[model samples]
Target: MKKFVLFSVVFLSLILVSILFAIFSFSLLFSQDSGVKEFEENFNIRLPRGTVSEKIYDDYSGFHNDGVKLYKFVFTPKGMKSFVSYIEKQKDWEKLPLSQSYQALIYGGEVKDFSGNVTGFGGFAKEVGLPKISSGYWKAIGDKSVITARFIDYENLDIKTLINLNSYDFYLAIYDTKKGILYMFHINT
Candidate 1:
């Protein structure tokens, strides 16, 4: 009877902890556009919808939207460091089935508290006065493998899209290469 009670208590505790973690994670991601701030701070790029002023390309992943073509994702130093480390450690990456910059942003997410996730912190100080995102990070997956979704970058296309990842199941491989920071776009059917 004691063992049974202990096991049950442990199980319940685990479940409760999971729930709390989920809530905290969602709160961090969903509250006050934290992901956007993260992007702005890390990479010197701005992906404002309805405004594509570049010749976008995604031959590697073949990821593109209807009008705008999104191919490469941008990365930050911290983000690049994390990515390069992960890739160098494994030398292989797994592509997921999620589209949208916001979804891609969650790839190397840190389990920071509200402050860590926030735009300004000690180690994670928010990047300021950086020019909007220009050319982002690019990769040669499998020597040219068509992956999940679409990528868009045009010189002009007032493209206003709201992208949010409801759950936290997206992950990306890290690499330390010429591509400083890493961002991803899905280009699949």
Candidate 2:
């Protein structure tokens, strides 16, 4: 009876800890990204009104800079339908991020002056602080390819995992930390 009770306690504690971590990590990511935060405000993202600006998105590095229109998700204060249309137009590239996206992500590496061969999870792990070996874990998920990388949230001590990229072979799957949604980018090189 004592052994069973102890196991239950341990399991319950782990579940509780996981829940706490998820809440905090998602908070951190949303807080950091104004766009994501804006989306969470009302379950919808209302982009600022501009001259149809373009951004070169860097999915892995997490930067909002760059100048490209593909996968841009453009929108106006009162023009989200168009935004949806824009998103739909690029459905073709949904299979994998555009080549420019990959370039943008790599460019982020240059801008940050980070040195490493593997940018997806390997770089994200070191950046998040989940022990060097804990990163770049490829799961044997049958035909489906899943790559889970743990990132240490400096703002919070909890770790976050990026899961299921969808397109391409790489996918970001995160656990215990929020940031549940994945921002995927393509690698040009």
Candidate 3:
């Protein structure tokens, strides 16, 4: 009876240790830092230091929009500038033209006509200046069955610029006319 009790205790301890080891191994395999590493490798740009969030989704499926894996990295002012500089160094990126109408909106000017012309009103342009870069007229096509969907009227700007690297199109739109935040997206075509 004494021998059986001792063996039972030993067996239970081994099982517990095995469970703990497996948990640790699984966690190490899927650590968040690994996501950051993967992002840097895929984009060829170092992620700015700040809060980073990641989501993996099926392509064009469900409520989650765009990319098989989406990573949003929000940065401080300094980090934003650093990232902007990094993008500026890329060979294929170019400054996108800002239309007069879009400029008016950015500067808080009223749109007098539907021609999309900029009519500056306040000094918002002088104060805030233009966003560093904006890009894309992103058509978020959710359903293929809908043939007659009206396109949302928004001035598409290339915030930083656009680049085609390794058969993938990269767009970095730092400012949304509505949201007024820095963001980026890429598509592999």
Best by TM-score: 3
The sequence of per-residue lDDT tens digits that candidate 2 reaches over residues 48-117 is 3431322234344334321211112233434544433443454221322212222222223322212333
Worst 10 residues of 1 by lDDT: 120-129
lDDT of 1 by residue, 1-189 (tens): 999999999999999999999999999875644334433343333434222122233333433422112323344445545545544444223232222332223232223333344221121001211122333322222102223212322111111321221211211212224435344322222
Give the RMSD in angstroms, all C-alphas superposed, for model 1. 19.3
Candidate 3 lDDT by residue in tens digits, 54-123: 4332254524343333334455667667766765665543344345433442334554444454343441
By lDDT, rank the candidates, best first. 3, 1, 2
Model 2 quality (TM-score): 0.20
Off by over 4 Å in 3: 1-30, 33-35, 54-70, 97-189
TM-score each candidate: 0.23, 0.20, 0.39
User: What C-alpha RMSD separates each model from the true structure?
Assistant: 19.3, 19.4, 11.3
- Residue 73, model 3: lDDT of 49
Model 2's alpha-carbon lDDT is: 0.30
Best of the candidates, lDDT: 3
Candidate with better TM-score, 1 vs 2: 1
